[model samples]
Target: MNSQAIADRCEQADVELIRLLYVGNDGVVRGHAVEQDHVPDALESGVPLPELVQSFNALGHRVKDAQFDAVGEVRLLPDCSSFRVLDHEDRVAAVLCSLRDSESGHPWSADPRSALSRQLADLADEGLEAALALESEFHLVTDGEEPSPHGDQGVYSTASMRNGHDVILDVVDALQAQGINVHKYYPEYAAGKHEIVTKYGRGIGAVDDYVFLRETVAAVAESHGLGTTFLPYPFDGATNGCHVHLSLWDGDNRFAPSDGDRALSPMGRHFVGGILAHVPALLALTSPTVNSYARLRPQAGAAAYGCWGVENREAAVRIPTAAPGERDTATRVEYRPADNTANPYLSVLGLLAAGLDGIRNEIDPGPPLEADPANCDEATLTDRDIDRLPTTLGEALDALADDDVLRSALGEELTESYLTVKRSEWDAFTDSAATWERERLRDTF
Candidate 1:
């Protein structure tokens, strides 16, 4: 679809406002909406947004060292293919945009979406394709002075499903109305917690679908007079996670084992090896918040150790068992160390960069762990070469700062900007009051 087609559909749908949306470095969606009359021009010429927005942190503070300020502007070049009329909001539609230099019309160096596109282009050069899916978990709460969970029934309970059935079904309807497919939905481990799994998408479209899913969930939940949060540690107990599932293809599923006895193909092992080797640094982009560390602890079901396993939730990377007779199509790697706090574009980019590096160099991932690393003795852990993931946002950032491969993949501008913004967040978190942190982060995603 092109600008004219989008404008025509907007007119037919009576869309009064068309939002040109983009995800900021802070993993938040920021955008401006235009009136219906301006849809065509806005889509063609692009909307101007302050470049300094790329330097802002989650708490809305600008990182001074990010090398961007109020003096310049970037264009939000709307991707017409992503246009969708809102099913929940009346007279409104939205399309995701890519940031471009206003003068030269080139992709901005610091754009997260553009960064992912660069990685995809490199992968295409190798004749490889990737598919990704997200298992999103979030909490629905009552909106008030002190928000609380909407339901008390625990994980996977029929009672919990009964309580949230209406709103959850409504969310599903809204999403499907916008052409996003739902693979499954269920009540999660904690009260008011729920999980929604969507069908996988190819290449950059996968992350774009994720962005839409997040926004749609939030919007539909709000319409029910309820508040929703994607924070890693919205409260104690079970934390919300947005686990990533990835699979590679080169005419066939590359991760699939050739023989029935093997766990993964040689190429698959190398990919997992790259992920384990770079996970400490990758966490800077995956679980990228001060509060995110609170969820990455041992025995939390959020991966704590850098290792891969078959059906092991405790490992950073897990190779799920394929359904009988579906090995070729279902084989994939599940990366469990991420949450909703990450910018999906950058998170997937880092994963691809690490995996591709492993493939090129044929890096061995060592042996897979069949049991939880937390239950293993220190000596056993040492023998297996498993290391605990970074315990804090600062520690992860430090690792990212030293990772030459990841830094090169992200490019100097984006890498520097991301580090500056994240470091400022870490400093603020360390210096602030606990109450302030909780209040500010409760609904950030």
Candidate 2:
């Protein structure tokens, strides 16, 4: 919809506020709300935001980066296509914004959303497109000094559904009201954990949908007098992971194998190969935070090694089994090392860039590991050429610094700012006297 159309809809709906939303470098959604009277002008001219927002850490501390000082401004240019009337709130509407230079009106080099758009444009230039769906896991907890799961039911059990039935139904309703389609919803492994799968979206719209999904889920849970968290390791028994399912297409499913016996097409193999080749560096964006590392351990179902397999949970990438007759559309790769803590736009951008590089160079992903990497002995691991992913955020950042391919894809300004902000987070976590896990980490995400 255009600005005028959005204004008309708001007028009809009696929307009192319109939020101009954008995800920050810290992977948190931050935005300014405009009164209904200012909707048209804000949509047209964009909302001005401080340039230093790109340099703030997740804890809201501004990193000491020289390039991202508090001297300039960037405009939050709302994408009219992303306009949605939030059903969970009272007379409030929202639209996702892309950061643009305040004076020049060009996309800001440090804008994560714009970065994803650039990657998509490059893929379009090569006659390829990507569809992505995110499987988001989060926890619902009761309020107190130490919050516990809201329900006591087990994983995937009917009792679990019965326990959280009202809240879950409300969440689905709110999402559908905002035009987000829900594919599935189920109780996850832990007591209070839940997973929601949404229908796939092409290009950057997938990430935009994910942002809305997180916000909607959180808001609905809050209305029910419960707390929600997407943190990877909120209370330890189970981890919250937002696995990314991606497929490449050129008017057809390129990931589908032509031969009946083969698992993936040549292009699909190359894509997975590229992802494996860059797993360590990719984790800098995928598993981004210090808290995220707590979830990426062996035997934890979070994928601890850089390998691909058919339905292997221990490998970072997995080729899921397609439905009996829906192979063409169902063929895709699931990257499992990610969580809700990472910025979705940057994570998918890095994934696509790495996969495209693999296609360009015909990077072979070698043989798929049929067995779990964690169970394999050292010699077997070496023979199969499997490598462990970075065990900590600092190590992942170092890998990202050394990776020329990813750095070039993210560009200099974004790379520098991202690194500076992440490194500062690492240092803060390591040096702080507080219980980093419970005190600082639990409530942030």
Candidate 3:
């Protein structure tokens, strides 16, 4: 859709307000509201917002090294293709934006969206296309202070899903109304948690859908007299993860795989190998937050090591099962290191960059683990074989700093800003007092 078409739709829908949305480096959705009369001007000239918004830490503190304060402003150029009418918010519509420099009218290098788009363009240059999807898991709570609302049925139970049936259905309807195709919705293992699967999209569309879906879920939950959190650990019930699945295609050919056999093509194997090699640094973007580490432990159901597997959830990269006939289109990789807290643009970009690097260099991924490392006997697996992921945010950032390839892909400005801001977050978290520290150390130690 063009600008004129979007304007026409807004007029037809009687939209009074238009939101130009952008995602922060820490995965927060920040935007500015424009009046109906100013929609055309805003779209053409772009909405002026501080680039600092993108650099702000999760606690709202600005990064000292980001240079956002020096520049002061960046134009949020709306993507006409991503225009969507909000059903929950009255007379309000939204469009995702790419941050651009006011002087040059070029995409800001600091922008996560721009970083991902650049990586995607590289794929296009190589005659390859990527299809991506994110499966989001979240917890619904009646009140934050109180325990979550419980259900009798277990995970994947239809009855448990029906417990919040009206709200869940309403949320799905709202998403569909805004053009997000939700494929599945079901109860998760945790008492108050649920998962929603959306249809795959290409490049920026996938990132846009991810942000829009998260906003919709939170908004609809609020309207239904409940609160929703995508936090990796809300109250120790279960972690919320946003697992990503992706496949590479070359026109008519599925580069990842097409045959019924579980074996990946040479290119596919290298791609997986590339991710396994750079995963420690990749974690700085995939599972970024301080609390994110709480969910990425050895037995937390999240991947704790850098390895590939077939139908093994414990592995960082898993080749999912698909029927022989459907394998041509369905064969893809599931990346499990990420959580809902990650900024999708950065996470996906890093993943692709790593995989493409692997393909270019023909990196070998040793072999797939047949048994779950956490459950298997230690005799079969060596520490060198099951290379564990970084256990802390600080360690992950150190790895990211040393990785020249991944750093160059993200650009120096973003790479520095991300490291600076995240390091501040780590310092604050470590210095702050905690209940466990006081309860154990103050009395016993």
Best by lDDT: 2
Off by over 4 Å in 1: 433-445
Instruction: List the lowest-lDDT window of 10 residues for candidate 2.
Output: 432-441
lDDT of 3 by residue, 150-186 (tens): 4543788777777878778989999999888989888
Model 3: weakest 10-residue lDDT segment is 253-262
Clashing pairs in 2: none
TM-score of 2: 0.96
Write the residue-wise lDDT of candidate 1 on 1-445 in tens digits: 8989988998899999999989988999889999999999999989888889989999999887778987899999998888899968889999999999999999999999989998998888889899999888999999899988889657788999999998889889988988888998889889899998999889988888888889988998888889999999998686999899999998899999989987899999999999988999999999999999999989999999999999999999999999999899999999999999999999999999999888889989998899999999999999989999999999999999999999999999999989989999999888786778788899994
Candidate 3 residue 221 Cα shift, in angstroms, is: 1.0
TM-score of 3: 0.95
Residue-level lDDT of model 2, residues 367-427, one tens digit each, is 8899989999999899878998999999999999999999999999999999999999998
Steric overlap count per candidate? 0, 0, 0
Could you tell me how far off, in angstroms, the CA of residue 230 lies in candidate 3 after the best superposition?
Answer: 0.5
